[model samples]
Every structure is written in C-alpha cells, then in structure tokens.
Target: MDIKNVFQAKDVPEAINLLDQYGEAAKVIAGGTDIIIALRENHVKVSVLVDISSIKELKEIKTSDDWVEMGAAVTFTEVMDYFKGHKEYSGLIEAASLVGSPQIRNAATIGGNICNASPAADFVPPLLALDAVLTVEGKEGKREVRLEDFLLDKGRVDLNKGELLTTIKFIRLRKGQTVTFSKLGLRKALAISRLSTAVYLEIDDDEKCAEVRVASGSIGKHGLRERVAEESLKGKNLDKAAIDEASKVLSNEVEKRLAGRSSCEFKKDAVEGIFLKAVEKAMVHNGDGSYCAMGTQYYPRAAGKE
Candidate 1:
C-alpha cells in the first residue's frame, strides 16, 4: 500500500471535506474488505485514505413506519443483529450472514459491498429486489438515486469525486410482501457466489401475484433486474407453473445476455434452480413462522462447510 495520508473522519461533513480536498487521490474506506486488497494489488491508486468507519452518523440504522435506512459504515454483522428477528428482512439477513467468514462479516460494510460493485456481490441483488435508494452527499449537496440506477457497471457507481454514499433506504415490507435471496457457491463457508438471485414478492387478496421483482448476480456485468421474468409472474398465481414459467424466462434471458462467454451455458442452466429457490422462499412467507428455512442459522459454523 503506497498510501501517504490517512484521514480519520468523525462525521459525514468531515469526510466530505477530506474527499473534496483530495479529490481522485482520496478513497473513502469503511471496512477495507475490498479497498485494502485493491490498494495492495495496485488495482486502486490513491495517495490518501479517508476513513469513515468511526463516524456515528455513518454507523446508524434507522427505521420508520414506511422506510428502513442504514448508514454507509454499518457492517454485515450489524445488519444481521439489527434485523435478526424481523421476517421482512430475512433476505437481507441471509445475504449478510453468508458473506465470507464471521471475521469478514464483522468488518465488511454494506456501503463497501455496493460501491465495490462486484458482479457477485451478495447484498446487491437483495437491495436491487427491494428497489432500494441511495443517498450520496458531496460538496454540492445530497441527492437520492435508485439503487439500480446508482450502479453504472461492474466496479463502478455514480459516486462523484467528492461524494460519499451515506445511506441506503427502502420501503418497509408490508403485509403480503417479502424478499428472499438464494445463491450458488462452491462451498458454504467463505464462498464467493457463482450465481445468486433475490425475489421481492407481494401476493394480493385474490391469491394472485400483485407484484414481483427479480434480481440476479454473477450472471451479467453486474447485478441486474430480471424484468422479463418478473413480468411473467406479475398478476399470476405464484403456483408451481408460474414459478417454472418465470424461471424459464430468466434462464433464456441469461443465455442471451451471456451468449459469447464460456460460462454462459452453465450459468444459463444454473440460474433456473437459483431463481426457483428465491421465488419459492418468497412465496412461502405467508404469515407462517416458517418464512426463512434457514432462520438465523448463520453459515461457517462448527459444522463443516459444505
């Protein structure tokens, strides 16, 4: 790491000022899970590091009647703890809990996970499914951008030179609405996702799908909404046939998008199972306590990693 200066910011304003002063030469670091590796490998060139991990405002998790917001520095362990017993956030909990080993989860921040913009980022698919919004603050002002729009491409976001991603917000899951996530990895412990899917589902009084949003990871340049599959499920009963139809749509889209890649054949086939799992998990949350099959069973436990 060829870093010269490291600025420990106490708050958002201070962090922004540091970033404004250093511009492209400065990098905002919270967990250092990704950036540390990038800097060591010379993938990122920066002379100064602006640390925001200790900022109180960046570590807060706020909830309201209609929304849930989490600060940029909140770790995955923090996410698991705060939303542990809440069934509406089971998808988020599952994603956060499955990130790397426990030690890595303790240090990995949600903001870093999103900003790093890896195609296989676990939390991103779930956030995308929830239609989360990001708050970015800079010298100019604070502005909100939809999570999908904020992500420009792999390893890229809309954050400007002086801006920092402050918070991520999404509508609270109401009755009949839930989000679920599933991923295929080589092993259960410290396994990076080969493919993943997240489903946000709402079933109406008529037993029909009121709304459905599907997002996927590792099957594209970045986490992306499977809109065609979503369209297939909306307004239809979330029965075996509907889910199967949607899975087929998702698989076909994957095939088309990854036609020239060597992993295309495998991913196009593998995505069906992963998508099915995510949607089924979302549908099973019909007020039953059995919403999350894994219910707080964090991975990489004493039991062998499988």
Candidate 2:
C-alpha cells in the first residue's frame, strides 16, 4: 500500500474536515498501533492518512458532577494513572494495565480499542459493564451512542467513513457500587484474552443485590451483557448459592452462543469459573468478607459488618 498523503490536524474540526474531504480514501491514525499493521498487510488500502495524535483537544480527560468524559486519543497509561488506587472502577484500570506492554499502553488509545471492535478487546467488557457511551463527530455534527450499540461486529463499528470518534463517557459509580474484571489470556503478559468477564454489582442497605450487570468478551460476535445472569441475581443475596446460579446462567448463555464451535464445550465449562472469579473480586472490593477465600463455605457476616 503506497501512501499518497499524510495530513496532521491541529484540532477536532480540522480532523473532521480532512475526513470529509477524503471520505473512504482516507484513514484516521492516532496511535498507529492497529492502522499501521492493517496498512502493512493490505487490509486497509487508503491513499490518505489523517493524523489526529497531535490534537490536544482529543487527548483530554474531563470529569463532571455526574460522569467522566475521556477524549478519543487518551492513552491507556493516562487512564491507569488517572484512576490509580481507585478501587471502585478497578476493573477498568486492570484491563487497561493488561493491554499489551508498557510501550503499547503508552500508545494505544481507548477510542482505538473501541473502534477496532475486536471480539477479544480487553477494554470492551469493563466499559460495557460501566454502561459507557461514545461521542462520534463528523461533518454534520456530533452524536452519542451507547458503547454496546457502537460495536457492530468484529472489525466493524458504527463510525461512518467521514466520521471520527471524539469521546467516551460513562456515569460515575456511586457508593456501594463496583465493577471488576477477570480474564483468561494465552499468557501472563502481552497475550490476547481467550475469554473475559466483567461484573458490576451494587448492594443495598439490606445486603441484597440492588443492581447487577455482567458483560463477557471473546465468547460471541462482540462483548455482550449477560442479562439472564444479571436478572437472576437482582434482589438476591450475594451468597454462594446465588453466585452459583448466576454462573450457571452465564454458562448456558455461552453454550447457546457458541453451540456449533469446537471451543464451545471448553468455554461453556470455563465461563462459570471465570464469572465466579469476577464476582468474587467485585464482592471483595464491595467489602464482602464471606467470599474471602475461594472454594470455601459461605459465611455471611453480621449486619453492618464491613
């Protein structure tokens, strides 16, 4: 693939203008981590490259009273640094920390991860569990879409040829709410995830589950919410029995999704363990001592026990 032109935009408007001018003939490059490889392999044949990595506006991370907005170009290192030691959303920090190596983390942007739309993207499950929304910009204007909807399929997104992703936003988790992630990768570091789960749970004053959201990756076409599992856990005690039932629900969902594949049998059995691990981590962060040790009997603490 021979490059015809490389244009560097100074701001969002300029980037959108370049995209509009070139249409499908141009491609956007931020970190150049994924795009460069696509170009090398002839997967993407573009005559123009619009470089948005230098745009300061696209690299900002903003926090508000209700939500946090991360610019499209914000790197994984930036996100990890910003939320370091913040256990409420440690799932996101953990996922970001696991993306490739230190150099890759410094170069890979959250927007690029979402835009790539890989079935095994490390960041998708945690973001989905967080109910994140994406802000897309184009010549017409900017519009927002839920992260779940923005991902169309593997290697595909809702982004139009003349559009660029601007920001990702999600509501802040309040007290008694936490999201945690677990992944089974090919190796300890710099390995792609084979399967992963992210659990978001909120316990009420009575120690019953007030809200539950489960998202899984590398099991279906894209990262998806495990509604059946979530529904089963709602208003229920977060004890061993409830956790086991929820894990069974997730296993069934995975089996149904990958019925004919060779990996189905392995994944169906593995999902339960992974889901349980994610839930256990989430419970620990939420101050649940009953799940202090895995593979042990449940012992519910007295009321008001932290």
Best by TM-score: 2
RMSD in angstroms, all models?
Answer: 6.6, 3.6
For model 1, the run of ten residues with the poorest summed lDDT: 296-305
Model 1, residue 245: C-alpha shift (Å): 0.7
* lDDT of candidates 1 onward, in order: 0.88, 0.86
Model 1 ranges with Cα > 4 A deviation:
285-306
Whole-model alpha-carbon lDDT for candidate 2: 0.86
lDDT tens digits, residue span 68-184, model 2: 888999999999999887788889998999889999999999988889888999899999998999999998898999999998988999998889999999888776778889998
TM-score against native, each model: 0.92, 0.93
Provide the clashing-pair count of each candidate structure.
Answer: 0, 0
